[model samples]
Target: MSDTTVTSSSIRNLIKANIRNYSMVLMLALIMIIFSFLTDGVNLNSRNFTNIFMQNSYILLLAVGMVLVIIVGNIDLSVGSVAAFIGAISAMLYNSGANMFVTILLSIILGVLIGAFQGAWIAYAKIPAFIVTLAAQLLFRGLTYIITNVSPISLRDDNFKQIASGMANINVLTINGVYYTALVAGVVVFLIYVVLEIQGRRNKIKYGFKVSPMSFFIIKLLVIGLLIFGLSQRFATYRGIPIVVIVLGVTIIFFSFITNNTVIGRYIYAVGGNARSAKLSGINSELVVFVVQLIMGGLTGLAGVVFTGYMNSALPQAGNNFELDAIAACFIGGASASGGIGTVIGAIVGGLVMAAINNGMSLMNIQAQWQYVVKALVLLLAVFYDIYTRRKTGLG
Candidate 1:
């Protein structure tokens, strides 16, 4: 074969292999560009960019936990209700003169216990996860109403409210209306990413695995680095990085490490990919499911705290449809319907896609109902893509 033909064939194979990894990112970019034009550039405003993270932080958190649950071949319908209940409890505690830290700790503990309770029924008793979580959803929703007396509990503590609404500007420097601290942080992040990528490539080469061409690798780094730097500059032009963004960032990093680097993470994929085979191989599938539930419950509680802070109150109807948003994000981010095929970063990107859609539609003054219709369509298309890919690969 001619050298040109071989080069073209290799490029085709590379694109085919990496399409799934980059498709959602491209889709997100496309949606942002389209919405920016539709909204006369309002969608790309710096303030609006920050609002995207602040407003959807809780949903993103739920998505992180939900993806893990889905990967374990289960679903937790109760997270929204659980978050509501936990938020209500936290508010009551704060009103009753409890310390803010204490209230937060107790709320998270309560959420963990609730998770364990439901997990026992699903994992040990072998009740269907769907049924158990569904019942808990109703049970907790009712409990929230009872505790809050069907009214909103106003939070008078500004410090507690800052958990979601505050900014973390370091006041180190500024250059042409951009915060230097944020710019520096962005540079640091890019550097770390570069290191990791090089190390990963080196390991692949060491293992005799085919690696991307050096030119393609350099292009990838440049593209991603520019994106990171630009995003930081955007945020710096605004009020600086949000407290919630920091929290969300930490959650993403932690969960990504857990899912990508840990032994339990491997077990989760193994169990989800084939429970029978995992069990036959002496893996404790039940324990994995239970532990995952506990983690989900804890994250749901943390999300509750953040949401309550964002609202500045614990409302009786808080967290409505949150589970739906999280589930949709997981699916849109390329998670498999049959489980065992998702990533933490993908879930976050999926969440950002949902946030962008909601934010952009609102900016364009579209009706809320129409927004729902559009979201439904997007979700359907995402699932269709998943099915198509699976069938194409003969995995379905």
Candidate 2:
């Protein structure tokens, strides 16, 4: 082939490959566009944009842990109940002595214990995860009521409340009568891309597999650019990006890296892909499940702190129905039901998809019932597409 013709063909291939790789992201963008039109741009406001992210952080946190659980061919239906139970305990401690530090530490410890108990049943006892967690849902939820007696508790600690409300200004940027924190975020993202690229290359070489070309890297960088620019503009008119955004950003990077780069992450994936095969391959499936549950419990504890601090109060049902949201987020993020399939970026985007729908509908003053209907349709369609694509590609 002529050099020019060869170059043209390679470019087209790169473009096609990227679109296939990020098909979910494109769908999310389309949804955003539709919402922007319906809301008359209200949903895209810098302040509202920041609000969407902050409001969804708890679900995002849970979804991260849930992704691991689902990847290992199990589900934890108890996280919502567990989170509420812990919050209830925290409230009791607060209501009793108002010792924020002590209460927080106790709650985290409680989370570890709860998670380990459930993990032991599912892993060591050979009980199905769904059943163990379902029982936990009932048990912990009952404890939540017993601990608080159905009374909502208010947090009185000023510093505790500020943990989720405060913003750091060092990264802030003022532009065109607005402020932006993404300039710093942009730098961090670029560095992350470089690190990921180096690691991917190293891994491909280590495994002696063919590495993707620079064109692939270019596409990845371009997507990152779009993300930073779009999100930054959404926050440029506000005071700056909120601290919650930073927290979520860090969480995304850490989890994404851990899952993509670490040995633990691969074991999780292997266990999900095939537990029996993974075990025969010398992977400690038992340890993997245990650690997954351990991390999940810790994350739930963290989410409780965030939700309480953000609201400046802990309700009797502080984490009501959050497990459902996390599950939906994972499924909608393109994870397979049969397990061993998901990405951190996909999981984060899935949360954004939910937030976008919520924010957009609220902006348009749509009734809550209709919002549910619309979201249900979106979720169903995403799953249907996932199954269809996998079958079409013979991935099954």
Candidate 3:
């Protein structure tokens, strides 16, 4: 091939490989801008911005686990149902005068058992994940209904309520009506993010891998820093800092580290890429699948707790359609349909995108049916984009 042709081909391939990464972020920004305008700037109001996090917290947690499942070439349609079942259990325990700590622990244990049961059927018995989780979806939902007997379980514990709705106890300062606690937290987080990113780039250089230009890197960090600080300021105006946000931040950091820097993470991608090939390479594909599901279940339990706390009760229908939202977030954030590709950050952005759309539409008094249609179209387009890119790169 001519040098010019070769250069053009390489550029095209690069774009195909990474377009989703850029597009997801840009799409979120675009959505925020559009919704801000559509809602007459109501969407960007301090209270509304905080509501976005509080409302979508559980979904984000589910999306974190969902992305990992997708990366391993599996799906867990039962997450929402499992969450509801666990939440129901927690509510019953709380109402029975059980200690909040004990209630949480038992709920998580229930989640583990449920995940292990489904994982065994799918991984050990050689059943398809779709069938196993689909069955689980019905089973768990039915269990939730049976346990609650079609009634909502109310929680009247103040300590339990703080799990999702409480603010941070720390106070940095109160300056000109802006709570400095949020800003300080944002600054600390931004510094940590920047340091880790720069260190990662250095490691890439040390390993003889390609790296982005310093200019590009700096600009990217600046943009992300501003976004972090900007949102923190907004959050400060409402509540100093939400406890759930702190929980989410910690979870994201931990999972992001594991997926990028751990051996098990590589095995997950390998199995997803080709399970048979991975097994032949001496990787225990079944064990990996089993462990992934177990982790997913634990996270689902955590989500259940947060969600239950958020509503101050657990209704039989509380988690209805939550799985769909989590799955959509993964795909929309750029997870490959056939698996072996995704990121923690992408899933967060995708969930935020979904949350933004839902929140914005509700603010405008749009009907539920139309909201569903719009979200369905958006999810379809996102999957289509994934397929188009994969085919272009001959990976489909």
Candidate 4:
């Protein structure tokens, strides 16, 4: 074949190989477009855009941890209960005149201990994670109710509430009712993304690995940059970026680094890919499982705090079905059912997809039951796609 033909063929193969990674992005965009038309553009409004992030912040946090748990070939069915239990404790502490910082710290510590307890059983005792966490789902949920006496504990602390509901007020620059801080942050993020993409491409080339065509690479960067700026503009038109968004962004960055660049990350994939092989390779699979659970517990605690702050109270049903949402996000975001494959970015995107569906349906006045049906279908299809792709790639 001619050089042009060869280049075109390579591009096609590249796209085909990576379609799974970008499919969720396209799906999210398609869903947003359809919802925008159905809601008469209300779904695309700045206010509603901000609301989606605020409403789904806790689930997104849970998904971050859930993806890790799933990546290690384990599942956490008790995150919802753990979150509620921790939120209840935080509320009680605040009510008893504890400082906000202390309340948050103690709540997270309690969560970590809870995780350690469960992790010990699954990792050291070789108990099935599903069964252990299933029992924990019942255990912590009951504890949540008993501690709160089946009543909601109100959070009177405005500062604590602000964790989920507040906005940054960096008045460094504002013009025409727009916050320039958000825009500046957006530009910085876009620049960092561009730099990283270029560096990654260069490194791949250096390592003699095939890279996408330069034109395709540039286009990818452009699209991502547009998205970054577009979201920032939306937040700028509102009340600046929400504090929860900042928190989520930091968490995403921190975990992304750990997963992408750390040794523990490889251990996780190794254990999930083949426990026996990983153990033979001296990977200490049990330790990896234990650490993964510990991290999940910490994130669940943070989610509990955020959810409580958002509601300004610790309701008895504070985190009902939260585990389902987080797990669904992971599956939809491209996590393999058998584990050893997933990304923090994928989890975030998966979460955004879920958030969009719920928000869109609510905007259209759809019933909650139908929303659940749609989510269930979406999740099923996502897993089906994963299986189909794995088989086609000879990995299944």
Question: What digit string (tens of lDDT, one per residue) describes model 2 on residues 97-211?
Answer: 8576787777777788888999999999999999999999999888878877788777666666654666656544666766656656666677777778788889888999655
TM-score of each: 0.94, 0.90, 0.94, 0.96
Cα-based lDDT for every prediction: 0.89, 0.80, 0.89, 0.91
RMSD of each: 1.9, 2.9, 2.3, 1.6
lDDT tens readout by residue for model 4, 86-194: 9988888888999878987888888889999999999999999999999999999999889989999987667788889899666358888888899999998788777
Please state the error at residue 187 of candidate 2 in Å: 1.7
RMSD of 1: 1.9
- Give the TM-score (vs. native) of candidate 1: 0.94
Q: Which model scores highest in lDDT? A: 4
Top TM-score hit:
4
TM-score of 4: 0.96
After TM-score superposition, the amount by which residue 309's alpha carbon in candidate 4 deviates from its true location, in angstroms, is 0.5
Between 2 and 4, whose TM-score is larger?
Answer: 4
- Give the per-residue lDDT of model 3 (tens digit) for 137-175: 999899999999999888876677677888778755777
For model 2, the local distance difference test gives 0.80
